[model samples]
Target: MNDLVERFEVAFNQIHQHLKEFNGYPKNDNFVELLQRSKLKHSVIRVHFDLLKQYAKLRNALVHERIRDDYYIATPHLEVVESLEHIKQTLDQPPEALEFATHPVIFFKDTSLLTEIMTAFDQQGVSQFPIYSKDNEFLGLLTNDGIVRWIARSVDNNVVNLAGVTAKDVLQDGLNPSIEFLSSHGTVYELEERFERSLEEERKLKAVILTESGKANDAPLGIVTTWDLIKVDRRNEDE
Candidate 1:
């Protein structure tokens, strides 16, 4: 009872502090106002606003009214405490974790000429390229490193038909391009878990490609790289 109340208060205060830090507002702002402002900035909070408001009322009751000496009037139910904890965790997550990617992704067809591919790479400054088949099936990724390796092998073999060679011809066996497909609505936690699992399995994950339905054949909506996750984490820490 008392312990649950204390935990609830702690969680509530944590949420309050997070809101203050995020909004860069004075502590003089009321909790409800801060929450309302947060809803405007975070879609997660907007989705859970009603429940949070109810929890705020409960917290107030637990803290304000006293039924006996040295005891508060209300003891928060276990469910309320759990809800507060969940909200706190959600709020603690960085905004980038929930942000949807919108950057343009450069891709190529496996049959595309190596000359054309290099031209696109030079013009776009893209290092990673998702290669697909003519029917729009995802074949594999064509990274700059892969291109360099293929060029070295071609030079060793005294082959000079670089313009005539296709991306499929230069495809190296056993390079093991690491890519994953995720839905546009997929959560950041899901993205993090996939990356973590790949690391645990000692597999190099290069990109997490987002699609409408998380299918390989679907057109990519966005892409996430290891660097993107690192940047997001760093930004969260700075905030």
Candidate 2:
């Protein structure tokens, strides 16, 4: 019982101290207060907040209501201790977003012919391509949805011309090219939060483009779509 209590407290204090140092929260503030405030800045904290809150209450009972120095009134279960330690380890080294993202992203020039894109789609099974200018500046995304829209509008008497159309032309048809950018170092948890936030704002976040600096102008490193978010959730569940 004493060993279990000690392990639980060790994990709890490590997590609390990490949250404080990472967020620069005052040392005088309580664990719950620190968690509530830090959750806004860290997706990991936000995701595990309810459990942490429960742990905080248990910690108070174990510390303040002690029957003796060697015997705690509340002896934490082994499962609870291990759970807290796991969370602490995650906080110490969260999974990077790029680890799950589609990397070496296939991109096309705005002037690239739609025929080429269609061929790549067939051969690579890729649904979207980031269209860039000759200078390598991102113009928009060329998606299957956008291609379908273009095809629908381009059907002139049941004949659509593909030779003259460019990737930029398909982009102009219908698909929302709006994208969010994430830094290469961003965590998987933060990527999930960004997608959720976009849905909450009622905006169609086409995809999250990973850049070296999380800026639109920076060259893209990878991409994360809603489908990728599903993968993240699945992996979390498996873990």
Candidate 3:
């Protein structure tokens, strides 16, 4: 059986390593606190924090749970180990999904209410969104997590109260959401290098929006995610 403690250690170490990649401060006396200083995109930073908290909880379970074969108690440990490897590889993998989810890409009009966006997010497990105008003009990208940060900061920013502030205001104002372009055609390895290099400077590693043109202002044809890549990797490993 896979040792949960060791697996947890690996999980924490991987998370820590990825965090360092995204956290761009000069240096820090403590590592965990370093994330607070990440210069990455607002939404990417938020994803990092959420991932961190989840791994911490998994680590706690690994440390506290007792394993037994009699009742198949080891399954959870194996599952977690699988998940740990999955998450680590997703963040650390090369660009694009090896076999990304064909889950129909979700979006909202620039003029629509946040509730519509909220509904899309809730339904599709929206990791991020590519904002678009009425003419299908690419506005900017936004992550569901970015919305939470916007809410938290809007009170202090005072932009929330402005009546005329449009979706473009909430989007293009300053909440730099990370974005990636789908390769018109190329090796995923080539894309991975770019993605990793992008994160090396800060936390905002924009996702590669798979599209027909893979060119600017082109309509998005599909989506890919780190999680999708990780799952593909795990499946490959099993095979």
Give each model's whole-structure lDDT: 0.75, 0.82, 0.59
- Over the stretch 1-239, how does candidate 1's per-residue lDDT look in tens digits? 78897899899999888778656777567888888876655545566778789888888887777676568877888987897787788667534332645366778887899889998889988787888889999888888888887777667457656767888886644453789988877776567656766877899898888887889998877888777776545443343
Task: For model 3, give the 10-residue run with minimal summed lDDT.
Answer: 38-47
Maximum-lDDT candidate = 2
TM-score to true structure, per model:
0.62, 0.79, 0.51
TM-score (C-alpha, index-matched) for candidate 1: 0.62
Taking the tens digit of each residue's C-alpha lDDT, what string does model 2 give over 118-196? 9999998878988888888877888887888879887999998787888888776656567888998998767866876
What's the candidate order when arranged by decreasing lDDT? 2, 1, 3
Clash-forming residue pairs, model 3: 40-203, 40-204, 95-192, 179-206
Task: Give the C-alpha miss distance for residue 131 in model 3, angstroms.
Answer: 0.6
Best by TM-score: 2
Comparing candidate 1 with candidate 2, which one achieves the higher TM-score? 2
The regions of model 3 sitting more than 4 angstroms off are: 1-98, 156-166
What would the C-alpha RMSD of candidate 2 be, to one decimal place?
3.8
Between prediction 1 and prediction 3, which has the larger TM-score? 1
